[model samples]
Target: MTPVSAPPIATASITGLVLAGGRGQRMGGADKGLQMLHGKPLAAHVLARLAPQVGVLSISANRNGDAYAALGAPWRAGVLADTLPGFPGPLAGLLAGLRAAQTEWLLTAPCDSPWLPADLAERLTHAALSARADIVTATTTNAAGEVSLHPVFALVRTSLADDLAAFLCAGERKVRAWYARHTAAEVAFADERAFYNINSLQELAELERA
Candidate 1:
């Protein structure tokens, strides 16, 4: 796919949901989203991209509302119980985001992806609508020619809460597996670097260097 700008869409009509909770074991056990990058929290970068595009929004986190709350966006705690016992994962978080979402369209993204394109929400929404799909995923490339989807960076119908809730209850935690159960498209990123996900301290350090 050729790289292109993310022209705006119906920002006043959709909802933005930030996934802010993670075990962060890779960063030596801290809230990865709260980690400071350039003296600012990573969550700050996510909120900035999300706030201008959606009319309503919330953060889906676990264990620490106070810090998540300070971002000044309403927050939804991860419903660990919402997923099948012993299979807790991002599906549970998405369930919570979908439940709390108040718009027809819901945009979900993680807090640690700092360099996401400015028009991510709009482009994802556009892809979703054009495909006539229930969901649209953002995929980016790597130097090894591997293209991966940021499952968190998806545009879904808020009404799918029931479908998502049912999926989470079936002992399914893998996002791609759950996403496969629907008619979805992988929207390739023209600039693969934008889909980078920071999972470890070393990765974050490398990102800082870049």
Candidate 2:
């Protein structure tokens, strides 16, 4: 008998959030998400790739909400600001996304990773359902066969919003630490370049030139 595979998660059941709410110290304090890559904002590139993968789209921007909102206009995406002050980190953004999302799952990716895999949400959702995990993140293996975890590229249940809020209230800012508290699974992708995140103006230039 042929084994039946689990059905793919409905795109409408997941909300996508681009974590653009960073201090951008590496980019000389300039908003990293606003940095242009190939004549478009880096976050714009991310949003373009992410928008089709989920039912709703949102941006986690601490600055330049208007610009982000405009970028999101194509998808009618919501622009969210971190509830916790001082640009707490991606977890804060995750918290905001979780709270605002009407979907069962929230898929997150950093704004600077314009080349994020198109299959990110589908793969993560599959891993989450298979493992019965609360959170699922992406991983990649380097040329040397060293595995690296990309915790920021994750899918989490919106149900964890309260737990995340409490964790942030207690000053726990680490992303991996919060995931450790839950049942988390990791899905490996073959292409490492798909997850590349531009950190500085120099890196953006390098990527553009490449």
Candidate 3:
């Protein structure tokens, strides 16, 4: 896959946040982020990429603190922030991250997706800045160039937390639904394999081999 140049990644604009709060139901209800990918925990691999890109590294873990705390990064517990109808999910974690971020930009990736690109945070931030976007997300394609979107891989403004929280209160829970109301850029990863989230034990097994 050909890499597109992400607009200039000014180090001043972004803070990294890893969303780790999901209740991992598919992998037998275990903490999927805590599961080992190789020699290290899944979240650890994400932390390696995350801590380097932003001035601060924050983990959004809902129910487990010691489990996630041992990773040694600053952690924030996700609240039942979604006042929206049907129990809004990881958006709760995203809301927590945006609240904790002090920087102008917040770059986020799901904890279960450990193989996210090294320049992910930087690239997403650049994509947003370059397009004068409200938010920026990662996209990738297969050999045929069919685009796939990964909304969890995003760079957003800290200022949007209120809007997002308000959206939740208004009974809008889906991330894509809220994102549709804003200007967003999809920075293609150009490689579909790069953004897969290990939501199931089957995928975790595959990641171990990768």
Q: Mind sharing the TM-score for model 2?
A: 0.95
lDDT of 3 at 43: 87
Every model's TM-score:
0.85, 0.95, 0.86
Q: Residue 168 in model 1: shift from native, Å?
A: 1.3
Local distance difference test, per candidate?
Answer: 0.73, 0.90, 0.74
Model 2 lDDT tens row, 1-210? 543332278888989999999999999999999998889999989988888788889999898999888875667558999999898889999999999999899999999998998888878888988999999999999999999999999999999999999999998999999999999999999999999988888988888898
After superposition on all CA atoms, what RMSD does each candidate show versus the true structure?
3.7, 3.6, 3.6
Model 3: how far residue 67 lies from native, Å: 2.0
Residue-by-residue lDDT tens digits, candidate 1, 58-133: 7766756677777763433222223334327677777877776666778888878877777777678777778887
Output the better candidate (1/2) by TM-score. Answer: 2
- Steric clash count of candidate 2: 0
What TM value does model 3 have?
0.86
